[model samples]
Target: MRRPRSAVWLALRRNPVFYVAGLLVAVLIVMAAAPGLFTDADPSRCRLGLSREGPAEGAPFGYNLQGCDLYARTVYGARASVVVGVCATAAVVLLGGMIGMTAGYFGGWVDAVLSRVTDVFFGVPLLLGALVVLVAFPSGAAASPWETTAKVVLALAVLGWTTAARIMRAAVIQVKNTDYVNAALSLGSGHGRILTRHVLPNAVAPVLAWATIAVGTFIAVEATLSFVGIGLQPPVISWGTEISDAQAYVRQSPHMLVFPSAFLSVTVLAFVMLGDAVRTAMDPRERRA
Candidate 1:
């Protein structure tokens, strides 16, 4: 028989998609963490005199209509996008895990009530619901951008978690009655112990996969909000704000729109691809392959 692939290499070896996605994601994390590694120019300082300049020596992405270094702005914009995406994803995982795990493990009326509530949330479209929530707290000044970011994060987290909750519930339900669970119950383990120690650990893997996908999803949602001039206002460097700024100048300066949009697309695609790879890794059929 052929030598078995090691666990670390299995995903990448069987599916090159993981390797490509992982590489792109690593570059983005680096870009988000240390933007200066990419450029030293200031994103905000603009010179209208050099409006829409094409790629040159120092500025590979060239100048925007306002004459700011497009490359620097794009690089700096990564931090804000990544932060919102990550924070929102964390909130989704926390809220969804609790509700989903509890309802799934307990069953009976608890499951019925939680499932019903999830359905109510499910009926509301995510983007629409998040818009309603964010509209309540509009951004006013540069000094309070965090306030807008926070509310946007809150809205996305609250509305986006239902899917995760449903996924976890399904996973928990699948694992709740497994032999290991029965073994724990027979050993007289308390409900909490069985849940935290046995049930949650096993059921939560699928949630991790969902969360990887959610990070990209929430980022896109933030961008959508910013595109509409609601999420991240002026003075906040975000890919969404950049896109909104460049949208009107499409005919005049397509590069302005292209660069940021490209970055945003790649980031989102990276997360989604990573999520797919994770999901595949967890599948028993894939393992046997």
Candidate 2:
């Protein structure tokens, strides 16, 4: 008798980590989407009368020196972090997959050249490299938020893909030499056919797992940049910037730092846990569990 599809899903759902991660992600998605739902105050607007108020009846999370609601800022901040994380991860996966597949399949001078390029990026400090690129191109130069986001996405992607490329290259090399790939080649199949049909599919599993982990890494990088005043500038509220701004008044108004930092921490933890769950689920050893 065949097991029901629901049974399979039920078994997978029994993994506590996956459920926790899913709940966290769901909360973040909601926070990012309808930020106004969490608070009525405008994050950018300041009310002098309410400035620097501690957590109280009206303002539960308190107010910054400018009287901007901390809760609102943090909720909106989620949008920037989520957008950057998703976009950067996508850019890395696409570019890295192409480069890794080509180098691995062609293998020779092509592999050497690509490998060396990957090494160059790996040598650089990822966050610092991104900050330099971001600072070099002033936000004023960009026509719109979309333009600025595109540039940031590209910068992060360029730096982030080196690791992904290396992983994909290794996976491709192993998959290409497998029995099925050799069989395809023996049948006079074209390189393109063997790669797309027999090699890429098998090679991509590890890449998928890596990409999941990379989302959390990119989020942290974006946050670091924002904290240093190089990421998601004014009009774009990001958690890093919020936490950075809160640092000054952390002693007087700890809630300002607490709420935003909590959100960032939870979001990062969710992604990390999700990646771990995916890794375990994909592992052959775990299949028997």
Candidate 3:
């Protein structure tokens, strides 16, 4: 008998956290795709006449010190946050997954060398490593916004992959010893084929959950870099840059800080909840509970 097609959807529907995460992703996609449709004002262009204006009829989120519409900027900023989060997560999954799977499946000197490299990364805190990279390559030196984004993505990716690598390595090690994997090996399959076709498929579930969590971490990292004045430069709107710009006037014009912080918090929370949901759904232990 075939399983019900709606099984996964039914499971997801039973989890409110999953629903909220889906909603957040949808909102972010809309914000990223058509930021201008949400607001008339350009995020980069400043209106001298309306500088530092509080939230009003047209400007619900208010204007920044430079008089750029905060609402528009926040909406547009979603683009950077989501883009960086996704790209960084993909980088982590690809690079970390390959390194981990190779080490764990082979289980020899290969494992020792890769495991040591992973340990070295763990010894160095992720944020501190990212900060060092950002400082080394300032945003001002970038040729364009794309280049700046590339730098931020690379910095976060380098620091972020360690955890994923460790998690994936553990998963791969367990999967490599499973019945199907041994069967494949007994059948005289190539090591690469057994690892890729048999072991990786089963081992990837935990990595998927971890990758979801990594999205939130990357967003926070990008924001931290921007807050410290190293992330996405001017002419580009980012939640971190917006929040940083609002820090001085947080007391006087609370809207400046409030909106961006709220959005960033929501984005991070959404990803966290989503990661939990994925973990619960993917793990048989959690699902049985």
lDDT of each: 0.87, 0.83, 0.85
Compared with the true structure, the alpha-carbon lDDT of candidate 2 equals 0.83
lDDT of 3 at 82: 90
TM-score of 3: 0.95
lDDT of 2 by residue, 188-286 (tens): 999988888888888887788788788888998888888888877766788888888888888887887899889888898898898887777666577
- Which sections of candidate 2 miss by over 4 Å? 1-11, 141-143, 286-289
lDDT of 1 by residue, 1-289 (tens): 4333355256556788888988988999899899989889999899998788888898999888789999999999998889899999999899989999989989999999999999999899988998887778665555476777788888888888888899899999999889999998999999999988988888888899889898899999999998998787767789998898888889888888999999999999999999889888777677668
Best by TM-score: 3
The lowest-lDDT stretch of 10 consecutive residues in candidate 2 is: 1-10
Of 2 and 3, the candidate ahead on lDDT is 3
Residue pairs clashing in model 3 are: none
Tens-digit lDDT track for model 3 on 1-289? 3233255455667888898897997887788888877877778888888887998998899898899888989999999999999999999899899989888888899999999998898788877898898888776653687888988899888877888888889999888888888888888999878877888877888899888888988898899889988887876679999999888987788988999999999888888889888777766566557
Q: Candidate 2, clashing residue pairs?
A: none
